[model samples]
Target chain A: MDSAGVLLDAQGLGRFVPGTQQWLLRDVSLAVRGGDRLAIVGPTGSGKTLLLRSLALLDPIDEGRVLWLSQTISARLVPAFRSQATYLHQRPALIEGTVEDNLRLPFTFRIHAHQDFDRRRVASMLEMVGRGADFLARSWHDLSGGEAQIVALVRALQLNPTVLLLDEPTASLDASTTQTIERLISHWHERTNGKRALIWVTHDRQQSTRVAQRVVQMNAGKLLEGT
Target chain B: MTVDGYIELKAWQVAIAASLVLLNAAISLGLQLGLGRSLVVASMRMVVQLLLIGYVLRWVFQSDSVLTVLALAVIMTIIAGVAAVRRTERRYPGVYWASSVSVLVSSWLVTSFGIAAVLQKADTWYEPQYAIPILGMILGNTLNGISLGLNRLEDELVVHRNLVEMSLTLGATSWEAARGPVRQAVRTGMIPMINSMMVTGIVSLPGMMTGQLLSGVSPLQAVKYQIVIMFLIASGTALGTVGVVLLSFRRLFNRNHQFQSGLLTAAGHK
Candidate 1:
């Protein structure tokens, strides 16, 4: 792939047990371009989560660099980088307050200070997933697992991030809710009109094929392409 | 050596007061509380420690040298710093240094201000009578605040690891991600001092005021000294709690706005 279309590029990323020689992720390199859909499938304990976290700069890596827009990201620009490239955890984490509060949290950060929370925008997104405007007023604690994941998805999508690193975002949800999440993510990618990328890690091979255009397999801390 | 109209207790009289621990031990044994041995041991340790400190203070006072007073103050501050982090259930690397620096800076600054600016009657800035007690009181209270703050911070970070990381992943600055835990920790640390302040002069008599009253100082004079001590302690505890909490925040998060949860290990974990 040429560098022109690549939005996120990882070169030989590795993570190891601190103060030990045990490697958790080794020599993994991947390129994500705008409008690209990639799925990473792996068994439990195969370091897929670690790989995704490393790409997002959520976890420290023992080796290699991640470049954004063809330039290595600097420490000062990490927040800016994160704002454009967001990570979604398998389990949703919402702050104490209403669902709207959790959705509005990102705007409270200095990095997003220039942005304002758009309730109408969020309400419309909720409507896409069969949720009403009242869903936005629901308390965070009242949200079911699937509902929380929807909130997490809407929150990230509303930010208009260029890249989304999803770590099995619908792992525990039911079939229909999982489909809804997948559809929501697909819509998010398509809405950007080939301007956004997705790196999804999932256990379901069918879901991988359904949501992603390219499939990669991770086994024993190594990335195998064209699985 | 006793001042006129001020009664001095004899050695036997103090021994009689010391015997009160035996009564406590007897009650513990009768109740099968399993605290009899600990009660006796603690009382014995307190007696020895207090007696040794009494002799040390007397010697330093007689020497009347600035170095002696300052050296004792530094030693006390170091001990207080160590004691502050000793009981925490969780700790990160450099926690000792963080706690110690917080304790040393807050207590020393407040004590110096008290001696040099507030209580200006001392012949020298390092007057043992004024400086030692002031430092001790401030250090004691500030130690509690630092430890409480540190413990609460660790607990919040650990329990809410996902929440904190979620915020960071959403592009929060280190301060923004940690603002909630920091606020809670600082409040936890300051609560005791605030409670004491709320109850002062109403619910219970404070130690320094009681000491002054027993030493034949006028009630109004004792009250004034107690007020100064209370204010100094309040500032010291606030500063120390905030300092330690902020320092731990820096240690727990990096310049990249990542929450380094790995750095924080629970107590007794390798």
Candidate 2:
């Protein structure tokens, strides 16, 4: 009953294509604690993204439920849960607008309507990734891949979620861009004073060693202790 | 000389029907469009359908029962809804109900306004002569608008699934996530109405206006009828497209506002 210590708890989660018997992920269990920077490394088709998606409650699970801060998340409470523990895909989904337009989007939701769109705050967050205030006004079409990822990260980070689920957020970017994302996420976690957490699904072994406080490996839908 | 509420086509002039068949035959033969069989079949079917519709309308006009008018309107709504649903690129379990409710509601609201509020020359608002034709035109336009919206709903979801999910992850409700695509569908659905209005009377005469003119109504009176009907159509289409798209998008999510993609038909078909 007292899972207050756990930020997120994924218990024996499973997923399968609905009309077929084959399971894409099964018997997967993981728990994220506050300030834990956990990295998940695995082969290309090893279900890392599937596992992260399930943990974020983005995908419907066939066999298990997710508990956010010891409270079981029912279907009715998913949006709230997702708001607190958000998932970022490998490729950021941007609309046809300026970066400021996208950043202001979250406040449009009724749940977040109490919050106002803080342009000054966004400008500072942009500064963390070496982008200026004018970066917020840049068109979505004009942003390079690195700039897009930074925008996506800022978009999620500005929400001030308690947990961040990163699905190879820098999978294809060069080293500098990867470093920017890593540093931005690290600073975000560090500032929480061990009150926030992150889980990154990555294929790069070296990046995992450098960024993750503790690393886990997955193979064929099963989670394994990192060798 | 009068024929079917008109004085232009004399009974002896019915021979023009034979001339149309020959002209179509010449078009099919000369262009090698292979349209001969289709043209013949379509013309014959048109003759039968129109003749039957004429008799039905005559009976409806003779009657004064509100129930009879409603029954006919309900039947037409069902047919129009089914046609709209069939126009979708992807087949889903809910498009039938979604489109039907949309077309019925929009058509009913607009038709009631036309018959009861605008075109109130009949003894009662339920008079079949006024009610039937007004409801028919509104229903026809509403059906097309909604069908186009339904098709766009399926297409946009498949194409923009990622962006939609991104919105969901940001704490947006289902309605918020789909607002973009639904608006796009509604606009796409309304394009035909907008295009027709843009060129009405300038480039071509509309069906109802032309019919009124040929029936010996003064040009000014016919133009007035066309104007009223055009506004009715615009209202019906705008309402129908919004209704159908909103209904279609609502089913795309669950009570939790989580996007359940299973509501969509399998991809690769669109």
Candidate whose DockQ is highest: 1
In the order shown, the candidates' Cα RMSDs to the true structure are: 1.3, 3.0
- Chain B TM-score by candidate, in order shown: 0.96, 0.91
TM-score, per-candidate, Cα-based: 0.98, 0.89
Question: Can you tell me which runs of candidate 2 are displaced by over 4 Å?
Answer: A74-77, A116-124, B3-5, B8-15, B24-28, B58-68, B121-126, B266-270
- Per-residue lDDT tens digits of candidate 2, residues B12-76? 57667657689879988999989988988988898789889888888888887888888889999
Docking class of 2: medium
Off by over 4 Å in 1: B1-5, B121-123
Best by TM-score: 1
Backbone clash numbers for all candidates listed: 0, 0
Candidate 1: TM-score, chain B only: 0.96
Q: Rate the local accuracy (lDDT) of all candidates.
A: 0.92, 0.86
